[model samples]
Structures are given as structure tokens and as C-alpha cells.
Target: MIRNTILLAAGAAALFLSGCGEPRAYGKVDKTPYEIRECNKELYRGIDTDPEKHIDKIVVHKKKRELAMYKKGKLIYACKVSLGKNGDKGDKVQAGDYRTPEGSYRIVRKKCDPRLYKSLMISYPNAEDKARARANGVKPGGYITIHGQPKWNADGHADRFTLAHDWTEGCMAVSNKAIDALWIAVKNGVKIDIYP
Candidate 1:
């Protein structure tokens, strides 16, 4: 009888701990992965071909939800993107909310987002972000990146690029395909300027 009670307790504990989505706790997530081929296909569809393909600089505008790729001084590619809501301000992203940040950043690491389709991790809330946040009265939250969509959400699946209002938690969001291309076009240490 004692053994049975212990087993039941353990089982119950395991059940209670398991949350929706992945095993990630309420506020802990490292990376999420999804198929790259589809993402790549979707990203190129909307890209402007008029611009040449020698990417030298990239800029993401949160308010505009637009990404501009430049080679030297000439524009090579321009694609619509999704940014944060409430207008990107200082650093420190709110939990489960949508709002892209505005600042200069770099692609530190490239990883697959298991939760989203795919993602290119952008280093946000850097020293400057923290400093500004500290100077202000708000906290400088972390976990900012350029990623794709989460799993199993079909509402906006058809029109990922057309939606308005910044809708990311202090992270820039582009189509999975765009990110995949970015993974190849935009190299590490490339400067990405995100603006409001």
C-alpha cells in the first residue's frame, strides 16, 4: 500500500509539472525548431527582385514592419516584417506580449526555434539597451531575437506579412523564409539597425 501511494504521488507530480507547448517552464525557453525548407520558400516569394543581391547592411523597422537589405549604398531587397506593439521603446520586453525593440543589434547565434517555425537569434538588450533602461525607471528584460511563428497557430498563417501593429515581445519577426535567407545573407557581426 505504501509503495502504491508513492507511485501515485510521483505520477501526479509529473503530470502537474508538464505544461502546454514544450517542457519549458513559464519563463524559460532557449530555442525552438521548425522546418527550414518551407520557411525559405515563403520568404523569397515576397522579396523584391529589383534590388541586387549583394547584402552589405540590413535594417528592421518595428513601426513599419519592413526589412531593408542594402549592398553598399544601393537597396538590394525589401520585405515586410512584423514588429512589436505599443511602439518599441526602451529595452525589457514584457512577457507573452507583442512589441519589437528599436536599436542597433547583431546576429550572435543562429538556432532553430522548436516553438516557432525557425528563428535567427538577434542580440538585443545589449549594453546600450541595458544602460538606457537602467537610466530610465524601467527594467531591461532580455530574450530579443529575429524569429518566425509559433507552432499550430493558423489564424494569421495566410497573412504573416500583412498584419499591423508590433506583435513581438521585444524581438524582430520576419518570415521563416526571410530568416533562412538572412541566415545565409546576413553574416555574424553584421550590424542590424532596428528603428521605430
Candidate 2:
């Protein structure tokens, strides 16, 4: 009888302790939520802005670390992205601030860097950005781009070490292979909407 009573007390204490502890999920956890699609031959081909189902808009969810491409208001492609190291807080204000701006912008230019991979220059510091900076008495930073990993070894070879985290001054970064697909998929003047 004493042993049974002791066992009951211990069981109750364990239940109480477990209830006081942090709640935990008791199911299978999906570690990789993002899906990376295969880069087909069309992605490797030269830039063709006049495809039948072209992606006209790009949306970025900073908190989710996702970039989705839309074709006529439909989501066609999506990939994981890394923003500026300080991008989690808010919009970029000044030069060298290391925060990705939150706003609607366009791909003003397409730059091909042999070492840094392809880059789609974003038109940051729009009128609102300038106004906000002026109000804060800061210089509005420029030269924000959506780029790929560094060409540490060769042209097509990218250093995985550099692409592992958010480490840009004020740019959005993706994989080198992802940039190669985006380079052909998107063109100049496409709208890119960035959200916090």
C-alpha cells in the first residue's frame, strides 16, 4: 500500500512538472519548408522576356525568408532568400545601414559580376525613401540588388559557406543556381514588392 501511494505521488509530481514546462509538439516536424524546383533547360537559355507565361511581379516576405514570382497575379515560382543582416527590424534608411528596404521597387539594371554572380539591381531610395531619410536627417542609401552567391572558385561554382546566412550590406541574396534561373526568368522593369 505504501509503495502504491508513493508511486501515485511521484506520478502526480511528474505530471505537474510536465505541465509547468514549455509545451512541445508531438508530431513529425518538417525541417525544410521551402521547395527548390529543378532548373530546366529554359532557365539556362538566354534571357527571353516575352514568354507566354512570364513572371511580371516579384514578392518578398522578409520574415518568412521567401521570394515568390507571380505571373499575371498567379504564383509561378518561389525560393528561399536571405536579406541584410539587419533587415529584420525595418526599412533601410541610410548608407551602410545594412537593412533591406521595405517597399515597391523595380529592377532598374541587370549586372553580371564574374565573382559575385548575377545581380538584379533594385531601385531603392524611391521618393518615399528619400522623404523618410530627409525627415530622419540621414542619407538614403543606394545600390540595392537581388543577387546570388559569390564565385569563390569558378564562374558556375559558388562557395556554399558564403550563402549560408544573411550577410549582405543591403541586398537580397539567393543561390548562384537560383540567380541563373532568375536572370533568364525576370527582366528589366519588373516590379518587386518587399514586405516585412
Candidate 3:
């Protein structure tokens, strides 16, 4: 009887360890068909809309859901933002962990997508992120970005309901209209600071 009890305990321990071994994957990329629309120039009439306005910094307050733009140490614009679904807990630590990273990063790349609206690549899993993941014996995921909503259907319509929620895997999300402005306002190599 003692031998059987020991075997059962060993099996339970193995199950528990396996459960704790890896992070679960979250979020899905939408691939529905979409088309770009010509934005109304009048939509961005007020304030300084010039790319030369010298806006060079982005600060994201994850808990507060705020994204503020700065130019030469002055506030240029501010808007609401949505972070990863699991972002409230802490900075992302491994692949498949649905938490946005917190730290200083740069806009490494930019790509225009009809389905996803627009995307600004963030340099996640930097040296420090990699180090943390290495220490934990896990892979640090990549492909993090600041992007707009996806086209949900063939009509090129965006799901406004989804846009109003925090649902990304590990990226910053903004409205398509807001991304339009950001696309022109933000330049590559601009510094982005994400705070918890």
C-alpha cells in the first residue's frame, strides 16, 4: 500500500511540473480580406499635423490605457490605448505569454497592411528581455508591434467592438484613425517608453 501511494504521489508531481513548464499561447492574427480607404484630409485638421512638427517620442502607460506623444519635451498629442490581455500582471517574460513588455524600445520597422490597418514594429526581446527569458529557460517571443485593428470581413469593415477592448497578444493597439495619424506623425528610430 505504501508503494502504491508513493507512485500516485510521483505521478501527481509530474503532472504539476509539466503544467508549470510552459506559457500558454494567446491571441490570433486575422487574415480576412480588406482594402485601404482614402482617409479624409479634413479628419486631421486641428493642431499641428505636419510630420516636421518634430514629434519624436511615445510614452505608453499600460495600466492607465494612455498613449502620449512628445516633441522636444512638449506634449504633442494623447489618446486612449489597449494593451495585451494579460498585461496588467507584469512585463512579458516568455513566448506565448500574453503580456506587453515594459521598457525603453525603438520603432524598428513600419509596414502598411490592408487587413491589420497599419503596423509599427517594436524592438521587443531586447538584450534584457532575452536575458530574463534565458534565465527562465524559455524563449522570448518576437513580432511585437503597435498596430491598429483588423478588417473583420470582406467589406473592409473594422470591428469597433474589438477595438474598444484589450485583446492583443503582446502589442499596443490603437484605432485605425489614430494609427493613421501616428503613421505620419511617428518616424522610425523614435524612442518609445512603456510603463507598467
Better of 1 and 3 by lDDT: 3
Q: Please write out the lDDT profile of model 3 over residues 55-116, one tens digit for every residue.
A: 78999999898888898899988877777777787999987787889999998876645445
Q: Which tens-of-lDDT digit does each residue in 1-196 have in candidate 1? A: 9997875566444322321122243365442245545445545564312233436678976656688877777776777776554445643443333456667887665554445555556676688866776777566665667665544332334343324435554556566566556655765566788776
Candidate order by decreasing lDDT: 3, 2, 1
Expressed as tens digits, the lDDT of each residue in 53-137 for candidate 2 is: 4579999999898888888888887887877768787888888777899999998876654334467888888999999999999
Q: Pick the candidate with the highest lDDT.
A: 3
> Against the true structure, whose TM-score is highest?
3
| Each model's backbone clash number | 17, 0, 0
Model 3 per-residue lDDT at 103: 97
**Each candidate's TM vs. the true structure?**
0.63, 0.70, 0.71
C-alpha lDDT of all candidate models, in order: 0.56, 0.68, 0.69
Top-down TM-score ranking: 3, 2, 1
Candidate closer to the true structure by TM-score (higher is better), 1 or 3: 3
